[model samples]
Each structure stands twice: as structure tokens, then as C-alpha cells.
Target: MSRTAEEIGRTELGPRPLPPLGEQRVASDLSTVDTVLSNGLRVIAVHQPAVPMVELRLKIPFAGTDPMHAARAEVLAATLLTGTDRRDRIAVDTELALVGSDLDATVDPERLSISGNALASGFDTVLDVLADALTGAAHRAEEVNRERDRLVERITVARSQPGTIAREALQRHRYGDHPFTREMPQASDVATVTADEVRALHRASVLPRGSVLVVVGDIDLDRALAQIESAMAGWSAEASAVELPALPEVVGGDLLLVPRPGAVQSQLRMSAQAIPRTDPRYPALQLANLAFGGFFSSRLVENIREAKGYTYHARSSLEFTPSGATLLLDTDTASAVTAGALLEIRYELGRLGLAPPNESEVDTVRQYAIGSLLIATSSQTGLASQLAALAPLGLGVDWLTEHPARLAAVTTEEIAEAALEFFAPARFTGVIVGDADQLSALRGLGGVLMP
Candidate 1:
């Protein structure tokens, strides 16, 4: 019998129904933890037994950009996994491969972090290897030179990219004379760093006292603590606070425009200093900023990108850190509309303060902020990093658990207050990367050009 037309039509396309707007299951609630090791290592163990894999993060107040005297700490941290007293670099990597584990180490501006994941049963082995590398690894001169050259290459490449250039410019503008202005070392500087400098930084910074070990997986608190203690027996260094200057209050009204010549699009960035992570107002500020430009449906996106189609992407963020908070607003658009875009951004900032968002806008934005936080922490690494980042700042364990309630209860007045407190429409440090002629048009918008 010949196939009927209805049969063919039925098979070709099923009934078309609209997909749901968002996710069905909210993320699992944050892992509750409380404990501190005898050696003063803050241990927050989130026992997720369902997964056979475990993640560990050891964070010390040591980073490459943090020291003016030397790059030793950074070099040591970077080379931690490269080799050790018991194992050569090749042997260490081979061991990791055999265990089906991954190891990564890096030195940020304020923290030196070592993170890894391995099978729960292989935890002790991994920890032992990591401790060995941390305690007795040699910073070979050849390796240091190689890494220096590599970093210089990376920086050179970054400077060529418009986005990186904009970010670098933004950091310089926001920080001015502060240590925050100093970025990762360049090749020349890295090459000049002696091996002794790296050793000194390691001895001073990456020690048991200044570090926190966060372990999450199948291990119980007791096992986790014992394993870590056994592994880190030889690791001991003096407790020292990370030397950091209080971030300078962003002086409103300084506009810096970095002109990128012969460019089709202009990168726009506006940032100002705000509250620190421990500030009580931070939770409210986070939610308010979400409504302003922190999310896709935010006022900045709705006004500039969605409504006017000025650019492809636009977002803003309230950066919470140990040092302090920064309100960062950024976007990229054609040079013709660059000035208009900044104006719209400025208007958006002012609007948030001038008028409270309607109930629906407020609720929608609040749900998003809370929901996004829950979802982001679902990963072991994500959760570990979040806690590690917060621990040194003294943000309590309940910060995540109490976040939803705080976000839900945020008032319109508080939202407006946070907007006023953080976003300075009049005092914006501006950066634009485009052709010199394209930048001339921004002069009327009030900014100084740098050659």
C-alpha cells in the first residue's frame, strides 16, 4: 500500500510547542561546612559522596603582581607542579596521567592557587605529590628563563588584542597609583628576576599558615583533615598578611580615552570603586546591579543593545574582592555610536537612582541573581573557588546560604542607594580604542587622549 500524505507529514514534523523560558531544576543548595585544622589552615570540606572524584584547592596570599621586590613567589607557584624533590617534572606529569587526575597552579595578583581533581581513592597520592612540589621543588634557572620568555610572548599577544588592551587600560585608569595598576610581569622584567627571588617569595608566602585547603568529594571531614595533615607535614612557613594598599577611592571626572587607530569597533569601559566583599550592602548591590546591566535583560542591555541594537553584547558587574568592590560596565560598538553608547550607559546609571524599578522588574532581576548564584556553585571547582576566594576576605560560610533571603528582601530604596553609591555617572574613567579620527568625536563627550 502507498504511504499516506498524513503519515509522511506526521513523521516529518511533530507538533511545535514553545520551549520553557528557563531551567527546570534549580541548582542544589550550597554545601554546608565548618572546620579549621590544628595548624591554622581553614578547612571547608563539602562532602559530595555521590561523585567519586574529589577537588582540592590550596590558596595562599601570593601572586606575581603582588611583590615589587621580586617575582620569586609567582615563579615558584607556577613551577610547583613542574618538578619536586622526589619527582622530576616529567615524572610528576606521568603520575598525574596515571591517576587520571589534573593539576593546575597559578599566581594571581593577590593569591597563589593550586587546584586539582583526582579519584577519591587517589587523594593521598595526589596530595603527597603536591606537597612535595610545594615544599622542595627546585626553580631551575633554565625553566625560569623559558617561562619568562613565554610570559613576554603572552603579554605581547595580549597587547595586540583590542579587548585585552581595553582591560589593561581600564585597570590602569581605575587603579592610578595603586598596586592594582601593576599587571603581570613583562618579558624583560621576568628575565631580570633571579631564581633567589622566586625562592624567597615561596618561603615567605606559600606556607601552611597563610593557606587554606578546601576539599570536596567523597571524603569525610576526618579523612580529609588526616590526609591533608599527613601530606603537608613538611610544609611550614611564617604567617604574613598579603601586603596590599587600600584601593584608592575612584576620583570621579577623570576620563581616559585610549585611541585604537583604524579600528571598526570601539571598546567602552566604565568602572568605579565601591564596597568591599564583607560590606553588608554587597548582597543588595549585587541584585541592584543585576537590574542595571549585570544580566542580559538588564536596563543597560534592554536600552542600548536590545531596544536600540547599538552593539552585539553589553553587561555590567559589581566585582567583589578582598581589597574592595568595583562597578564595571563594558561594551563594544561601532565608532559612530560609541559616544551615544556611553551616553546611554550614563543615562542608565542615573535612571537606576532616579527611579525605582517596577515590582516585576525588581522581582525578575532578584530571581535571576539568586538563581544564577545557585547554578554557578553546582560544580565542585566552582564552589571550591568561591569559598576559597571568600575565606581570606572573612566572608562567612553562611554568605551563600543566606544570599537568597538577602536578595529576596532587598528594597527598592536599597537598590537605588547601591546604584548611587557605586555608579558615578559624572565621574567615569573612559577608554575607547579606535582610529584617532574616530576618537576626536569623543572629545566633545569629555575625555583626555593618550598617545
Candidate 2:
């Protein structure tokens, strides 16, 4: 009554061969103006007319080591556009809506980001509102009070989440007491933040020097540049925005098993230092990571998730910062299979280095990488985001336009070397959070430390 997949494929012209991926297309160069405003803001404007909308991404380095910095930063971001001298919260929202625009502001340990999009015809209106808020945001007492309360509630709930628990454990294990580890402020800290503190932090940290603004869409480069310069003339700071201190190099050793009293599953997070995008070997490393665990069909995902059912998914990716980069591998599994999953991950790491990707494997990942880049840049917002991300590293459209060729040039031999150097099991350190009683299997695994 039923036939197995193997049996069904056997009669279908002997197991169907997968179709070959189509040839990759190179992305065109963007006409861009990369300039520094008189007030010290780095502005990158690109004319990408794929659509009638313009996208804006403003990145301001907002790092700080003070005990209250994270809480105040959170509160400030939440209330940034709530009001200014010329307009109140409702007025700001109404004007943006009239121009078919939407904007949002968020902060992390390293930076404050303002991202938005608007109809190209309303570009000047969008810039006007952004400039108004940057120079004159009031951070009114009522607004700050409301957002601070909300932040506390959100942080309280977030702390109880397993993923949050795992992330905190991993960050602590990697860098003890580093400000970067302060991904989210404690609820108690947020509850104590005041409007005056928020305003003071804004004046001191929300600066222009060393910050970047990326504008991309169907707009003239010269006109956009002039508009941005005129709009932001009054938003100036004598001091540069703060930069997060360099992260301590993650030394390779045993995976730390962080105890969670009644957890049902284990969250595994591991990291090791790696080269930056500027390195010539980065393309090879990218391919190696993808083939190992960065994609669904990779060795780790196939072995642990598809074949063994140890976890739903596994990912190995490169995390970049202006200072450097690191390779991070993440997955979650039932406590019963945590050890097996770690073993498979390490085994695959070793296998990738020793066996190397063959020509066929390299070709598949190469195509995927090239195709992914093309698709990502196929949109105005995507292009703007990409440029914004690269701006901090002093790269721009040239690097993006030339990346496909670089990836195409990476060889299997190079990828294998990258895999060996960067993904070695001994070079990785991490945390596994789960019930102490259930993860006893990891003790005998020899690589992980049990609490």
C-alpha cells in the first residue's frame, strides 16, 4: 500500500540528479558619495533606483563602561523621537506618516541605530524630522517614565527565558564583567533610570564625530548630500562618539557547563577568534563555515539534525566587529542528547579540516554565497543596510561590488586551510546550559566541564 522514498526514486530514472545551479551574476556598482560632514558625521549616499523609496541607517557609536550607561542608553533610545523643542510625540508621528515614512531607534552595547524608509519624494521631510530629534530631543519626564517602566517589564520577562539564560551564561563565560556582556540592563537598573539621566547621557554620548549615516534609494547623490549636510548642521559634538573596548580574545579550552536548576534542554554556544573581512582568506573561511554548519545541508546540520535527530538546527557563523571577528557555533538539544550533539559538532569540525571540501562541495557553497549576496543587494533597503554595515569598517560599494569575484576566486584548498585554522575543536570555548542532573553525559565526553 505504501512505498519507501528509496523505492520510489529507484524507478524514477534511477534516483533523480539534482539540477545544477545557474551561473552567478555580478552586481553593478552604485554611484555613491562617501563624504564627511563639517560636523564630523560620515555620510554615505548611494543612488540605487530599484524602487521609489529611500532608506536611511544612522549608526552612532554609543559604547560606555559606566555602571548606569546601559540603563540610561536603553531609556534614551526608547524615548528619542517622543519629543523635541519644535514638535511633540504626536506631531512627529503625524508628519512622518504624512510622508509615507516610518522610523525606529534601537540601542545595543556598541551603538545606537536609527533606521527608516520613506517615499523618495518625501526624503527631505524624513531628514528634517531625524535632524530635529537628534539636535533637540527633550526626553520629557513623562515619556522617559513610561518607557523606563516598560523596559523593566520587558527585561524581567527576558531574563526568565532559556535563550536569555544561555546567552548571559555564554557572555559571562567568554568575558567576565565586560560591558559588551551587558546586552540588556537588569530590570532593577532600568527601573531606577530617570529622565535627567537619559537627557544627560544623550547630550554626552549621542554625538556625530565617528558616526556613520547611510542613505540609499532613488535619489540624486549631490542633492541628498546637500540636504543631509544642511539638515544636520546644528547637530554637532566636540568629542567623538564612544567606542566599545576590544573584546578579550576567546581562548580555546573546555566548554563550560552552566547550571540551570530545572531546565528541560541544553543551549550550546561556542566561539573562537577568527580573521576579519579585510583578510584575504576571509572568503575561504566563509565558504568553509557555510559548508560545515552555516547552512542546512552542511556537515553538522546533516549529521546531528537530519540524520541523528539530536537537535532541530545548528548554525556556525562569523560574528564581525570593527576591532576583529570570531567564529560562533550555536545549537540547542534535549539534555539527553547534549553530549552526542557536542561530539558530532567536534567530529564534523575535525572532519572538515582533514577531508577538505571537494570541488563539488566548494562549487555548491560558492554558488550559494554569490546568489545570497545578489539577492541581498537586490533591494534599496538591503543595499543601504549593507553599505551602513560596511561603513564602520571603512568599506563601501566598491567592496560589495567586487565581493562576488573574490568569493569566486576562493579555492577548495584555501577553504580547507581556513577550516583547519579557524574551526579546530581546541580553539573553541563555550557554555552549555541545562539541568546539572541531566547533562552528566557531557562529563565523560572529556571536552566539556561539568559544574
Candidate 3:
């Protein structure tokens, strides 16, 4: 006989003892990484004798303080691949094709990433071409114009989608007049960007002092460093500064409604601040988050989706970054039933604070978090990126290896304590995009509605 959800919830295999948490293990398998360079470029290289390919990730940090900058950065990154002084885009394409290599560039909030993968034999050529594109690429006016047109078209199409609209609305609501809130570039904004602006940004921000070059491959560290320095020797560090003011606390006790006409289902996003990556409570909180809403078998999924069929999925997690962090919960439900779903969400949050999870629930969630962490460490490429990313944020080399033990050490009582401090019913914020009339119905559940 199939067990009902009520049975599953109440079925407690009593007195299941948990193993004692062990010491944090440092990953000795990862090779020693060093930082130095010729000319003024900085480099971090790892020698993986087992793999024949190499990956180089370069960060360029001058794109925008407004939405306009976002558009400009995208155009500049695209233009990098179009050509250089030595080769046209087609010529470069032919060379990569011959070597079975891949090269691309992308822009993020803080920097531009230029990465390439190629056979060990052709690594030097790939590096030479990439360096040329970075330091002396021609930012042709014609290519800039074409990129601008393409970006404009993309923006127009993105804004028409309901999901994009909902996300944009949330950003404006959460980070008013802040750069972090900017999601996409506007057509008008992209059209106004000048080629000179792009050139100046490339010159000022994509230099050594603010950049970190990560190379992972099968090669001698000394030779790899030499090859990188020979190419970037002429490039010098430039003045680059980013002053991100503290984001204001997200306003709570309000319902943010964005009416999407003719919509059948409602998308709900709610969030509040969580501890940062460097916080001591991170491991415990991560485990608790997974149990609550971080995975497929989370409390949110069990209570809201699997049992009640209110939505297809529900999730929650801490968005960690260098500057700060936030805990976000998101799901979808029928527009008419949105209020009922939110009430249940609030109820669950309240319940988690009051009742500690039983032994079985804690053990299952702990095992899942540990398994996920282990999986994240398996790939050399992924491990290298995570290590590099965390090092910048002051996390130690032992962070990953030590994480599983820390997660295991978290008691149900401690998780309940974290929930009390982290999840605040009074401060929770909600955003809804659906029919205006339907959103109004939510006000009866007790909160102010902000349009």
C-alpha cells in the first residue's frame, strides 16, 4: 500500500542516532597555486598533469554603474571575438577549428571573463591569440554598431516575456536606484553608447591590478607563467574602483503585485537577508536551507508541491557573493490560489522556528547536503573556479573539504535556532505578477499591497 503524505510526516523511526561530526579535511590533491606575472599582469596557474587541455579565465571589471553600462559591456565582450589587428574573425575561427579549440568571452557584475579550451599541443597559439584580442583588438565602429543592434533586439524580446518582467519588477522593488538591480540594457540606452566609451572602459578596467588570471591544465607552472607573461608583458595596471553602497533592508509586511494580463499561474518570489559566505553559521544554515527549501525533497516541496499540488516546485537558498548575501524563496501557483499558498508558506516558516526537525529528517538532509558538496568538488574545472572565487572572498583552501563535517555537526536544535533568527514572519517580502483584481484579494490576508 502507498503511504499517504500524512503517514510519511508522522512516521518517525525513533531513536536513530547520528554519527559524531569529524574534523575538517584539507584537500591536499589540489596543486599549489601562486600569484605573480611579467610586465604588470597577475596570474594564478594550476598544473594538472592528467588533463591535456587548458582553461584561462580573465576578469575585466569596467562595464557599468547603470543599466546603460550593462548593455555596453555585452557589446564590448562580443566585439572582442569579431577580430584583432593580426586576424579577422573568420581567420581566427579557422585556426580554432583546426585545433579543435574553443574561445569565448562573457561579462558579469564585476568583470569580463575570457576563457579558452584547446589541445595541449596548441595551447601556446591559443594563448597568443587570446592575449592579442585582449590587449590590441580593434573595436571597429561597424562591429560595435552591429552588436548594439543585436543587443537591442534581445532586450525587446526579453521584456515581453512574463518571467523577465516579474524579475525586473522585483529588482526595482528590492534595490531602488542601485546598480545591482540592473538586469538588462534598454534599446535607447544601447543606441546612445559610443564606441569611444567602450574603448575607454576596456583600457581602464581590464588590467592587472584588478584582474585575476586562472590557468588550469597539464603543463609546467614555470613555462605556463612564462608563456602568459611574454604575451601580457606590455599591459599595465590601471586605476579601477567599485564602491557598492550597502543595500537597504528589503521592506517587509507588503505584497508587491505586478499584474500580468491573461496569465494562468502566478509566480511568487519572497526573500530576506542571510549570513554571508564568511559567516561561521554558513554550514549549519546551508543544511537548514536545504531541509527547508534548497532541494527537491525539501520541506517546501513536501508541504506545498508534492502533498498539496499547489505548484510544480518550491525552493529557497542563500545567494552568496563577496559583498553580501540574501535568502530567497520562490514558487509558482494558480493566480486565484496564490493567497492560500502564501499563507501556508508563512505557516511553515513559523512552524520551522518552533519545532526542531526529528532525527531522520536531519540525517537525510545532512546526507544530501554532503553529497551535493562532494559532487561539486569532483570536477577539476569546477573545483578550480570555486577555489578561485572563494579565495577572493577570504575563504580558506580547506573550506570545501571541511564543509561536510561542519554540516554533520549541526543539530536539529541549532537549525531551529537559526530558523528563528533567519526567517522573520514580520520582515518577509512578497512579489506577485498576475491579474490586478486577483492580487487585490491577497490584501484580505493581512498586509499592505505595493504596486
Which candidate ranks first by lDDT, i.e. highest? 2
Task: Output the lDDT of residue 367, model 1.
Answer: 75
Q: Compute the lDDT of residue 447 as modeled in candidate 1.
A: 53
User: Which residue runs does candidate 1 get wrong by more than 4 Å?
Assistant: 1-33, 63-74, 447-451
> What lDDT tens digits, residue by residue, belong to model 3 across residues 1-451?
8977666556377444556766434345756456656444456676665577776666554435755677777778878877878888887888887766888888755667777677777778887788788777777788888888888888889888877877777777777767766657676788777778788767766666556677777777778878887877766654543434457766666767887878888888887777777778877777778878889988888988988889987899887643677788888899878887888898878777776567887888888887766666555566667665664554534676677778878888888777777776776776788877666668778764745
The local distance difference test score of each candidate is 0.73, 0.91, 0.73
Which residue pairs show backbone clashes in model 1?
72-197, 72-198, 253-427, 260-434
Backbone clashes in model 2: 0
Q: Considering only N, C-alpha and C atoms within 3 Å, which residue pairs clash in candidate 2?
A: none
Candidate 3, residue 101: CA error in Å? 2.4
Per-residue lDDT tens digits for candidate 2, residues 168-259, read 88888888999998888999999999999998998999999999999999999998998999999999978999989988888998888888
Stretches > 4 Å off in candidate 2: 1-20
How many backbone clashes does every candidate have?
4, 0, 1
Model 2 per-residue lDDT at 311: 94
334 in model 1: Cα distance from truth in Å?
A: 2.1
